[model samples]
Target: MATSVGDTLEDDVVAIPWTSFCDKAFNCLVKHKHDAAGSSLRIYASDFIRVYEEILDQDLLLERCKELNPDLEVTAAYLSEHLSQGITKALKQTCTAATQEACMKIVTCNAGLLVMQLHTMISGVPFLWEFRMPAQTASDAFYRHVTLPMIVMIVGLQKQQEDLFALLNDKDSEISDYKRSGQHLSRKHLETKVFDAGRFRRETLTPKHLKDCLSNVHLNPFGSEAGLMYRKMMEAYKDITTSAREPETRSPKNHSSSNIPVEVVKETRETTTAMDVTRLEEEPKPHKVKKAKKRMRL
Candidate 1:
């Protein structure tokens, strides 16, 4: 059950009816029944304990803090007990089915406030977590959770990009070999242009492309016509490659030498050469032959 508070004068106190609260809640829930779910963080109640424990590990906290102050008053046992109690209380508070839904709203509405809210919920004391953390511990946690991990991810992504570029170069070489062998694509539009990474990145990172990505966040990528066509094309390519891997088996009766008759080919070439020679000779001798005919006539 949820409750709402109403405001009034200092001396006057007014209580809103429970029915009004229920009505408002129902309407609000229905309005966003079909949330877009783009760029939103979702954490289920069932996984709350694991999520909470991941950040609040007692040994890790103690080790990180101990480096700053060797005489630190907080012990591992105390930290563990404190975390256990807070987690239990937080779980009890968010045991309801709608807790996950409320989390989604909070995450999308004001993500910055989420950390504070979680601190309050887990500690059962507002802002207590802030004062407890020293500068050293806070920095270490930030580096571990945010900075270092991000650096690692960037490095991995760069390596993957290099691999992809190498693969594209190999494909370009294959296409060049085909061109050199006098093979042509059946469709002129199918010919690919040389790739320019800078231009491609500039074109892909446009505001319109960002909007398209956001708009498609909730769509099923594999449900589109382009996806179906891509699947069919891959299937055909796979079949062609599979067939190419197998050795050709030719029949003994159908020899390569018998494919064309040698005499017919020779005669055709001779006839073509003779026709060309006759035309060239006639062109040069036409005036001479005409003069000779006039002399004979005279």
Candidate 2:
């Protein structure tokens, strides 16, 4: 009698040995259930089921089993164990082609419920197995999908932080340059220096001293003598103006006429024409010469 499609696939699947993987997967699932809380267990179980379903192919399983034991009608539990063993053996032989092919077939052939249960068992298998070795020993698709993105995000954030630090450093340097250009000290450096509050008080309280201090502070130390002289003159004028505003000083109109010095008024005019007087004094006076008359008796 010709074997049915399901029987044939099942026999073929059973022929492939996967005992080690099945035992490992079962133990892992039991441990997972034992360690996890009720809520967590549900989540982990669901994930495991999904992975198991994806690794076990029903159609190929039935076909393979039918080829293996055509005369014997296998029960559901037997079929399940047989498929599990086959997948485990396939993963052991070569996790690259065989495992992937088996997983793909399972996912395609099984219904949603069966797929979930199968994947639960398959995912429980250890990464490094004593019996079966993985084909591609490097990272898997799961690592790329899950672990790699997380790593990339962390590295990206670190780079951004470094860039922010660099930007802050650049800004600080620019600020320092601006302060130097403006004839001002850096705030950071200023904080480290000792300040004389008394000096600041003395300078600010007096307008003359304030002007002098401001000039000295603002002007370049290498400025021309003329600039220094101008600053001095300004300070002198401010002092005079400030002195005149004192409470004890009398107004100009209230001053007595006797307070004006006669010599001061006269000397002011003399000094005004002193240059011309000197020029006149330096000129030579004309001499009167006596001439002798010659004989004009004719």
Candidate 3:
């Protein structure tokens, strides 16, 4: 049985609710099922999982953190522990069959909190996952989809890494950025820092990029469950893009009488000048009205 919450630490440990976690995972799965999975992430849950897998150690995770953004203050132990707890929660809840309607049925409970004398380290985001009311849409999508999967991909972790590799070897960060963009893991590893909430913030993520990524995955000639979500997203993107471009293309073609070009107006003025000259020649002048006045003067 999982505890509803974990023990508070001297270091900041953000507590994610079991109901919330499952809801997020299920929504992610459904969204992917409607647009199938492209990725997975975890760790006692850290050491237990790490005991087997030969991926990078905490040093690499922390190294990546330091390389990408010096300002981000996260530690490998903190991240690993969080992953382990998440995995622990996921393992307990995910094993049993469940439905979207009954999503809140499972909750995550922390077994206990242990503070060691030697290796004690504190870590995690200060944001408190403090998403303001009506959280930004991009941040929400990122958390539900990209964030979780990307972490797994970055960490090279699966829900059950305990079985993937022998428990004795080591792991590195060389393959951290390989997320599944298509039939295989994507090689286009964009260098982004891990666990920076601002990085996952709405202003940073482009929905179109994610849409493109998701859409390309569905076109994987091989069968996969990336449903019409990608197609729909593309359709939506196409519709909006086409609609946006339409006005720009037609703008120059829109001509009205009031907006006649300068050349045309000049030509019309020249034609009027010729017609006035013709009318002057056709009109009779005051023939000899001055003759009588000139005779009287003589």
lDDT of each: 0.30, 0.29, 0.26
Candidate 1 lDDT, 1-298, residue by residue in tens = 1110110001000100000001111111000000112211111110111111023344564664355334333545443443333332332333244442111112121212222123322112121231121122222323322232233334444555777877887898899999999999999999998776787779878988788656733232222343333333323322332333346554545333231223322222111000000000111111111223222110
- Which 10 consecutive residues of model 2 have the lowest summed lDDT? 271-280
Query: Candidate 2: lDDT over CA atoms?
Result: 0.29
Q: Score every model by TM-score.
A: 0.31, 0.18, 0.16
- In candidate 2, how many clashes are counted? 35
Model 1, C-alpha of 57: deviation from truth (Å): 8.4
Residue 131 miss distance in model 3 (angstroms): 4.8
Model 1 ranges with Cα > 4 A deviation: 1-136, 211-298
TM-score of 1: 0.31
1-298, model 3: which lDDT tens digit per residue? 2111111110011111111123322221111000002111111111111111112355654564455434445445543343333333332343334321111222222222211111111222111110011212232322322232233232322322433333212222333423332334345365433433343345446776567556644223112222222232222322332333344555444422122223322222111000000000111121222223222110
| Model with the higher lDDT, candidate 1 or 2 | 1
List candidate 2 stretches off by more than 4 Å. Answer: 1-139, 183-298
